[model samples]
Target: MTDYSSISTKYRAYNITPDTLAGIVAVVKKFTEGPATTTIYLDDDHEVKDHNLDALLADSFVKAQKIQRIKIESRKTLGPDLVHSISINFESDMLRVVQVTITGDRDRAILARRELDTLLHGAEYWYSFSLAPRSSFLPFFLSFLIPIVLISALSVFLTWLFGGEVTEKSTTGWVLLPLVVFLAGYFGLKDYVFPRLTFDIGRSADRIKIAGYWRNILLTGIVIGIVVKIAIDRLLK
Candidate 1:
């Protein structure tokens, strides 16, 4: 078999007419099963050449797949006169695939295309779909515990403010009030509050993560505050 690299190298050396460039890009599109975006970079002096090449790539990619969207971008840079980079981005409910392929071969370009497909199927990529939860014990504890402690402390303060006098008579109620509130908030808000505040963050983490540690703590505080208020009223009566 003729070496594709050798053929590509020869093709590059000679002036590739507009017609020939179109034919080449057409052949490359046959390898990819889906839509793609093709970018052609050429020396500033080669504007016509770049435009022709891009149009060719776009047309061929569209012809290859009805579902695929093809776009062509061209820019003139100092280094290479003619170079092509193709990037394909595709996603499904379970998986996301991104591929970048560059080649000189008219036929061997398919090698890069096939490599990307294989990568999409491999265990590393496929298993990523399972959406495993990541563990960060410290963050998780802080997310829940810190608020409970703070709210409980606030309740203690509020009891003192209410003239409960921090004496032994009032001490148990003061402490118990906050503790009860903290627990109630922690449990009640666990399902409602925390989930709402951390919804975006958790979902972004593939629904396996949580954030807003301080927010969770604050929510607990709100609950504790209400509990302390009720407890103080009952005790006064």
Candidate 2:
């Protein structure tokens, strides 16, 4: 089994009718709490309406039902879906609001969920990850930090291509290399990677693809950069 000790879950809720809203309010009241801020999505008009519990309870059934769907989103937001399909129950009296949640690095998601649960004890809630948890952390570090380092190293090494060394006399270039590298890597990786993936409701396949692409690119760049650097150093000598 995959160890969830390293993975954390995010909690959210839907199905927040005025009835459930009132129940949530009463339960949270015990702890001087309130209901989650609900964001409603309307299918007919394609509009989003945000309301706190108080406002939802005050609204008429027609208006509340206009909610069509609702969700309590976590701060760790995922990209919108490219395609979504839903089955509506016309015979049902209440909107079938779905609970949207996600799982991620254990420390962050667990802390957030624990606090949220403490804040709202009675609300129906669930948790999940937008993507599959990495079996390890190396993929994340590689995707996020290594690119910046690689870009910086690439910039500094490229100076040798012109038989120039980064020295105290070129303090400005050394200082600027990281910034230049950051922008280049940001744009380069974004351009190279994002296009290979698509955004969706959950489990971003694109990110997985990007991880593989990033590993390949990082390894390739290092190998090529080292070879070129060695050649340049020899020629210059």
Candidate 3:
């Protein structure tokens, strides 16, 4: 069996600052040996070209509009024709997913990954690959004891204060779900699941096995379920 013949990395951003963004762009441009095509995707679905990304991120208003993604692509001249591209996907104002796709032989792939590791090591706000570990902790009381307990207690207090008759078991899912959702929202869900399928027909098929897609789905379900549950309760009453 042959290898994937490509290398990719997904970077999750905690909060990408201006300096970090500049570093990210530099790392992306470094993948190519010569001039490359740099494209920026905007929130309005309008994509355009700008070298230093000045047009996309020039001012407060423009930045507020948000650059959804940025891509840099070029071929390597010294070696066999290799497809190299860097995709910077912005999930939100402070969240990002940086995808690096480089094609080459085993040795070259190893070196490229090493360089990527270096970049990831130096990046201040970006998390290297995967979204499951953080969000999965939200439902667990041990993880968010302070806020969960405080909010749960507050919910009971409000029920009494508003004369809703606070019960002995009043602190329940109703109070916790929204707090979990709010905390989950602040953390952000930034990575996307890669297409997973097998084909013997091709020379090589990319097998992407990512942990935490289920966790993300569960988190999403909890959020949606809470919304639906609220609607149902209100309508029934």
Candidate 4:
């Protein structure tokens, strides 16, 4: 016996708002290519409704429910060879995080995934993100390195500027360190951790590969901790 069926799965996260439901609906329509069954699990009542995306995602209905999760199975499609299952796990926070699990046939799963991303990123109100890339390390490394270098340089330059003996310590160093930490969190993490980074359609995120994303996150956490410690130490003195 030979088995040819292959399944592929991907995990993704998106920052969604009330305004972006239309984008989701459009993606669903394109995916199914016909009427689809959507199961909207509302906190008020958990019901499975065989409705189209537009009705399922109506603004009034959406506003009413504290959505726990949504399961959308493709009912009809131009490409019937693939089975599509989309699970949107909702998190109750200001970020309105939607962790999506996409399971599809192996060959075209990537294509199916691209459709949703295209819509999410193309629209103004939707955003998606994946694990940071290798290039991420460079900026974070710079974030760690540049602060000390700039501060050390400023320390000596300011002393010379003020007609004092050159020293490798200054108030500017302390100020810059904390500000760097604060600014990175305020700007970088805002755009990184949650998915609200300045984005272009279908182009904002890159998947963390099989090398493993958790390691990337953990390493970044360690770097962040070190950076913060340096800042705090400077602040205390």
Candidate 2's TM-score? 0.30
Model 4 residue 103 CA deviation in Å: 4.8
- The 0-to-1 C-alpha lDDT of every candidate, in the order given, reads 0.39, 0.41, 0.46, 0.45
Badly placed stretches (over 4 Å) of model 3 are 1-4, 7-11, 51-64, 80-96, 117-237
Encode model 1's per-residue lDDT on 1-237: one tens digit a residue. Answer: 222221110000111223433433454454433233343322232212233445643443322322211223222222344333444322221111222334343454566555433433331322232222224456445655666777677767767666665764456466677678768866776433333211111112222233245565676866887798788889989
Model 3 lDDT per residue over 1-237, tens place: 113356354434333344545555565556554445556565569676656544435534444444455555555544454445334443332222455666544555556556655654555232233232233446333434654465556555444433455567554345544556545643443222321111111111111123245446756865775677577779979
Q: In candidate 2, where is summed lDDT lowest over 10 consecutive residues?
A: 83-92
For residue 89, give model 1's deviation from the true position in Å: 17
Each candidate: how many clashes?
A: 2, 7, 0, 0
lDDT of 4 at 119: 50
TM-score of each: 0.27, 0.30, 0.45, 0.39
Model 4 TM-score (2 dp): 0.39
Better of 1 and 4 by TM-score: 4
Candidate with more favorable, higher TM-score: 3 or 4? 3
Query: Model 1 off-target regions past 4 Å?
Result: 1-134, 167-170, 197-237
Against the true structure, what is every candidate's RMSD?
18.4, 16.9, 14.2, 12.5
lDDT of 2 by residue, 99-200 (tens): 223244344435544544454334332321222223357654455566567666666656654455567456335546656766676766653433221221
Superposed Cα RMSD, model 4: 12.5
